[model samples]
Target: MAHLKAVQGSKAPATPPSRPLGLPGLAALALLLAGLGWLAGMVSLVQAALLLVGSGLGVVLYHAAFGFTSGWRRMIVERRGRGLRAQMLLLAVAVVLFFPPLASGTLFGHPVQGFVSPIGVSVVAGAFMFGLGMQLGGGCASGTLFTAGGGNARMVITLVFFIIGSVLATIHFDWWMSLPALAPVSLPETMGSANGIFLSLALFGVIALATLWLEKRRHGSVEASGGVLPSDRSRWLRGPWPLLLGALALALLNFATLALAGRPWGITSAFALWGAKGAAMIGFDPGSWAYWQDAGRAASLKEGIDHDVTSVMNIGIVLGAMVAASLAGRFAPNFRIPLRSVAAAVIGGLLLGYGARIAFGCNIGAYFSGIASGSLHGWVWMVFAFAGNMLGVRLRPFFFRAPYRPAVKGC
Candidate 1:
């Protein structure tokens, strides 16, 4: 679907085509939603709504190919800056929307809190691992979910190990918690909202300009390709959307998440819970881990996936991606795995999972939501994560002569 660039230079106006969605896929989605509803029991409406939102997330992510790892990698390795610039735009939009409500401390009567986490060793070490793991595993947290949903068989390997590593982190959470750390800090709290916004925007501008300059210097010029007249399906459903549009959608949806859940969007924590539950079912006693000592965390371990917000959202993302991929006729899953690639996936996935836990979040929770919510930890995470990516990119050649398409080349 993506390769079919609009008919270049043809004076004729082609009739826009509609992408027929796969009926079976649509049916599957319906059944999944029903399952979610049933799982929620008394809170069916709220649960269903979140599930639908999750599905929408999957669709947008899949159709747009909204990427984090790849976008950063393209800038780092290929000197392409479009994706990075788009991300800055996303942060800009998110910060503007998030800060105002978060500063006020309430939104429509629901208490709103920013994603404030401690500024310390765990974040630095974990984020560094996450960054490197993304390159090696072939996707960041969000990337892994969308790709796995879109029928990329190798990502399942990453997802499984990601869960294992996340669960393992809980066992070691006490030691990391013991590390020297500052209290959770937020720019909106320290600096006034207006001042924080100004500072954040200015930094974003600086980074955006730096990318633009670097791209021009290395590539000699930006991409020369002009937009081909888009087809109708490309506009909404079967799509390779403008990266900026993807970014904007993500920002708005994240804002919606705050409104609905009274918290920002998150991803990896669900993986940890899911893995722990699976372990508990097998009598592994993941519940005894210090991370589960918290009453809420301990209780959540006993509940089903439907009881977990992140788990439901993660399911929605996967199912949504599947529906989108199926509609786009791109839902092919090749299960055959190469030996070296398998090793990379295992190592990379473990790193991604464990790092996310240690860092207090994944790309979604820690970096994007964290920064947008004005948490200084987000900035710290990005720095170390990028360093990890630097190493991970260099190490890729050892595993595969070529990286997976869904990994870093795109989301």
Candidate 2:
């Protein structure tokens, strides 16, 4: 042993900077999670891994579906090095657990849910609408939470408007739900959960190929946009593939969450849940909230949205995201809000909460999960929401135009 004085005089060993676990750690975690899943009868390790993979896929799809400038994209780009990778890994683990291989080609005792409906007028219309709203709103349903965490006051405002839009749509839910025009819809008899996963994966591949082709074709076009990829990548990682893989992993994780949890991917319901609770707290009868008594409906509206598990899971998402941000040293004080904007956020929250209730989903529910689950209604919601988003974007400037506005300064 070294002498006490010599030991004291020696410089303290340089401590390694604590960092988020990378891929290897993720693998170990997955192994542990596999045991937990087996004991719980939730999923096999393979299935859980698939779910994690599904979420990984979502991250990529999300980038493609919405332009890169969106809030979620910004968050991912900003935190490219740290918690971002961890998040992707977590999602991959989740996907494998949620959507495991079936026994004798079946998920559950019966066939997996869903039907084969080709791209119809409805899907086209819905996709178009969803794209538009997502663009204008500055974030989608899931986008709302992530962006909110990132301190984008714009997203905060957009979320409120989203709630308002959702509520407006909900008031007519009974009528919309009963629409005969939405008929001629067919849930696939052959496409159980596993089959659907295969189909989605195939489609994802096609989309990926098309995107690549488009990128190559557009290389010289103005649409290609100089400085499109993050600057750090140009200096360090130096390619889109890493980002692409990272994103795909996210999408796969989402799928996994659906499989193991027996629920679709989503985040908006938390806002709705909080909204409903808030209403009840303020003497508003939740029963009169249209979808308040619609637990079953909401549950089906999006996989896992209405479940207690989903609620807790979303809480996990928030905590997880915050932790990720903190780990990356990206956490910061939130932006300030003008009084009217504050009022708008409150109003937006109410609208977004109620609207999500009426619409049966938010961005994730209506758009992301909807597209993944093959729901026509999800598509429709996206379209109208786009219109709503555009309407919102235009109107936002009017409601809260003062420069350098301060945030309301509280959660």
State the lDDT of candidate 2 residue by residue for 209-318, as single tens digits.
Answer: 54445444545321222232433432121112234343445456565555555556665655555554545568865556465457764543344322344444454443
Q: Supply candidate 1's per-residue lDDT for 332.
A: 60
lDDT (0 to 1) per candidate: 0.81, 0.41
Off by over 4 Å in 2: 1-137, 151-172, 178-180, 184-187, 190-242, 288-290, 293-307, 338-359, 376-411
* Top candidate (TM-score): 1
10 residues in a row with least lDDT, candidate 2: 1-10
RMSD of each: 4.3, 11.9
Question: In terms of TM-score, how similar is model 2 to the real structure?
Answer: 0.55
Badly placed stretches (over 4 Å) of model 1 are 1-19, 39-41, 224-234, 403-408
